[model samples]
Target: MSTEEFDPSRWDGRDLPYIPGEFSDPDGVALHDDYDADIDPVTYEVVRHSLWNINREAGETIQNLAVSPIALITRDFQTGILTESAEFVFFGQYLQYFSGTMDIFTKWIMENRAEDPGIEPGDMFLHNDPTVGTPHQPDVALVAPVFHEEKVFAWVSNLIHQNDVGGTVPGSFCPNAVDTYWDPPSIPPIKIVEGGEISTEKEDLYRRQSRTPQNLSMDLRAGIAANERAKGRIEELIEKYGATTVKGVMRRLNDSGQESIKETLSKIPDGTWRERAYQERSMTGDDGVYPLELTLTKEGDELTFSNEGTSEQAGAINQPFAAWRGTILSAANVLLQPEQMGATGGLVRQLNFRPEPRTITAPDHTAAVSPSGIYSNQVSLSMANSVISKMMLSSQDEEIRNGAMTPTSAQWQCHIGDGFTDDGEYFLAPMTNCMMGSTGATPKRDGRFANGHMWIPEARGPNTEEYEQSWPILYLYVKEHGDTGGAGERRGGNGGKICYTMHGGEMELGVYTTDAIPKTPGLFGGYPGSRGETVVLQDSDVKDRFAAGELPTDITEIDGENVETVGKGPAIELDDDGITEWWWAGCSGYGDPAHRDPELVATDVRQGGVTVETAESVYGVVLTDDGDVDGEATESRREALFEQRLDEATTVDDIVAGDEAVEAGGGD
Candidate 1:
């Protein structure tokens, strides 16, 4: 039983394993299954539903998809049809898993394509060049190619956000970067692997330019391992089903996605919805204000997401055409059937975009598109947010609401390498921070708090004890910053914190950040969440230090008071009082808070999400000390404030619905 022996076409076409109303085609026979064959008329009659969860999931995976866009089609080769299934993340965002998985595959494919092109079917490749396969350098991909009967069938790929790929800065994402050559280590799509073996020489070339070679190598290795796993699983699927059935299913899967898109297009009013907006970069690159304009033309069963109006930025903020398409398609899926699998290729036919190079969204070959030093993800999110705002005007989807939301993004990093301690023993230090921002208000709910990086999943639990015993670092404080969440139906969740002290031999640290000032905006009437910051400590005082600096030879945490900021000698505090606070920009609010439920307000207060003062000041909702809602007071106040506008008053049940929906929508 060799790994490549599976074929999907040999299955006896009896009733395949079905999930009733759910879609499942593991064996590839479903390629011929009529679209209406498993139909449940009652379940199919629904006209309105939230596709937020699915769309968000797709967003999470889009980066990974772009890293290995070509490899995503392999599921069809193995299963006899391309089933729109992707890996999942703890936060339920599909893009994260998709990107991670695809990253691994891209590397595998690049290594295998030339050497074991036939028998070694599950091999992949890794590269980051526009001419060969990918568009830019920061977006490195891991790809794997699938084969049937020694014939190449399909592929899988994943992408990761590398802060630096050579270049002038510690992180390669320099906003000031003008040309591709200015960006360091711009890897063209050359095979860094051969016959499943990674080229150490090539890897060394990458490490020479990267600030954190150990971290880069570790992450890259992880990606390769992930793709190997995908190859193993996909081959198993083919072995269980037969190649013909798998191929048929793969083709049918594309058909199904296209059909789903068509159905969604038909439901919307047959008119074009247009929106114009600009996306600003946090770090000013060679150019200023990388204006990203979006023009969405929804005509009947066809929709086009174009970035013709966008202006190119200095560096990696510029996205490739395929990557841009992935993001636009991801946003569109939110407005359509989010729960369905959005496979690559034909499923994206209905959605198209203009590929004018030199624009921020679709830059020319000479443009620097690395994301390490620049705020690339932020740029993409801003453009997507603009489109969402426009779509909400014609639809009831509050996810598109930009008024209540504030725009912000955060930067966090960890260092893991063979660092020596006092006794010269090897150690690894992983530092993670909560780079948070505001969120928009949903239809019936309040805005979410301190969420940064539309793509970052939750950080693993803080390793305080691990730091104390294994490494020479002090974990001073780790908690959520109070009053940081934005105001809305419920105030947004607060951002988490981290304070550490360095010791032993001098160690090098890397910090990646962006959206430093203007926060990522919120939707509806919800206010944006808090902004994020990173600093160092000498004594009890906070010190303004650059990321490329070295740490002291010894250090320790004095008290458990959880000092918010650290520095040398004098203890420096973050003066949130107007000056410093205003320095950190918050996104705008979404809808009106008066429309939120009083009960929900009470719960938020109990959970420490909203303070009594903010409740009174922002949402105009009052509560009792026992966390009970003052219904009479609430009703009268809401009525007076909203001028008897019923749409502004969300009931207790609605509040519950909104909260539940947020959890279901998949962000922590």
Candidate 2:
């Protein structure tokens, strides 16, 4: 359908199809008239734990086998179990966003290949098309069907972010692309494995399109292995408990998730909460900021999210309907049902999305969405959290208000480079410095430093030693930058900074895509974090200084032929003597900085998380020479600061003054 013709309102009332081995809707629907049975509590618990453990094991298998740092180090992958009807049953604790895409892919398989190739034992399907529920090109999904008594019982799925997928850029992030055609070749929902054997032609075709064929091949194998492991575990469950009981247990799990979410919603006050977030464009000449607006309405036990006034689809930053929906679901999972298992399809059924098509949230099929999973997904997620947190704050329950989590930083900071190693090995490396940023501050506590991205808290970057060994780069230092976090009563955590230079080879090509504007803004009276930057010093005096056993702590100390500041742009070549310095953006704070404790401000200054001047100016905290807070001086300075703020504050007349007021008064 064309973007203009699509209407999300039509998508709201569609009935969920009833299928065997899947959970029925909470409205009490059945797959078949004769298929009604009660699950034994003992058997239900056993099957539930089995499914959860299977997903966990499958994730471990992927982590063990995958060669890409995105998988092994960053944990940018997920494993899940689905019913025969393609309902999500259980998923691993990896990237929470990938939890919903498996069902979409499996359902497509069932609808398209029900009688053609057919869903049979040992069969596996592969897909990565954004139109078919994938968020981006690199996140490839592999699914395998589990058979019981010659009928489909469940499906096991695995998704992983490939190192490269043959896009305009080596890492599949095409900042220069204006359309989907510029991205890696889209793979439709198709069978890549049949009867437990890989299709050589299909596998070869898939691998041939990637820039790093060897790494992609290994990731594909890892996904297949994970799916196989899930299949075996499902079969074992069937062998232990009869098919009928297993199916009943699956239904119960869904019912539990549905009831839990409904209960949470009922306790929350009914109201409409709206919030807006923006994506800073990375492509040159695209200076416009794309805004994503979200309106969340809560009534009784149902929640509806609408993106009616968001920006239209443009650039490569757009997201498809599936990704938009997934982002909302992920946010809901964290805010409402965080303590429960995410396998239940009931939560997905309970919520509704009213996204106007042609917007960045619901882009046209032809639009490029290469960065949606990391960039736009983060935007959508933050917007969702912003609205939800507002609702929680308005609640009468003190626990709920205090437990709310403000929006965190998104994936606006990244650095990718491709070059040959010292041993003549070509390498495409994505710097993991983006993963070391702080999380958003909570209502009652400060944010966590080096806490990784908000989407995947479990994400981790490789050590300096590991990076030095893997690529031809030398890390001068990697640590938290001083005065980087957003200043508040409960300040946000600080982000890290990294300095590196070529060891034995020049960086033939490099891509620096990050947010020149701060993407993570604080809530209430808290200040927004600092924006990240990429500084490159070409033909520097690093070798001479290092040879003399004098290491420069800052980039200013290094003499260079030319100094260039690359801010969110396309790929460029780097000289051998160039030094690249990257500073990650900090997370948002929770309250006004002036309300912060003087002693705490002194501690922040001592730890290098805040400058002494920032402590004095922002927090109004005067520190003594020995790094201790001067209580008497701090009180006087704070009073003066408050008076200054009152003096500089804008009055109502300033807004309605001059020509605007004259026009309103009809004086022309």
TM-scores of the candidates are: 0.63, 0.91
lDDT of 1 by residue, 1-668 (tens): 01122231221111110001112333321122222223233322221011122223323343233221111211100111122231111112333222322322232233333343322444445666532324346556655555555544445445555534566434444444555676665564444555788888888877787655665676566556555554555565557554554444544445666787676555455444433343344233322444455666677666666566566534445655444544454444433444453443343446544444456655555666554212444445444654544454555434333232233332222232225577876443333333333344444444454554333332123346755665565554555555565655544545555555554443433222323333344444555545545443333322222133533222232212233321001212322110111112233444456666677767777887667876666666777667688777767766666664565776767667745643212332
Say which candidate scores most in lDDT: 2
Q: Judged by lDDT against the true structure, how good is candidate 1?
A: 0.44
For candidate 2, what is the total of clashing residue pairs?
0
The 10 consecutive residues of candidate 2 with the worst lDDT sum are 12-21
Q: Which regions in candidate 2 have their CA more than 4 angstroms from the true location?
A: 1-37, 561-563, 651-668
Instruction: Please give, for residues 4-60, the per-residue lDDT of candidate 2 as tens digits.
Output: 233432332112111112323222111221222687677778888888899899999
Which residue pairs show backbone clashes in model 2?
none
lDDT of 2 at 532: 72
lDDT of each: 0.44, 0.75
Write down the RMSD of candidate 1 (Cα, Å). 13.4
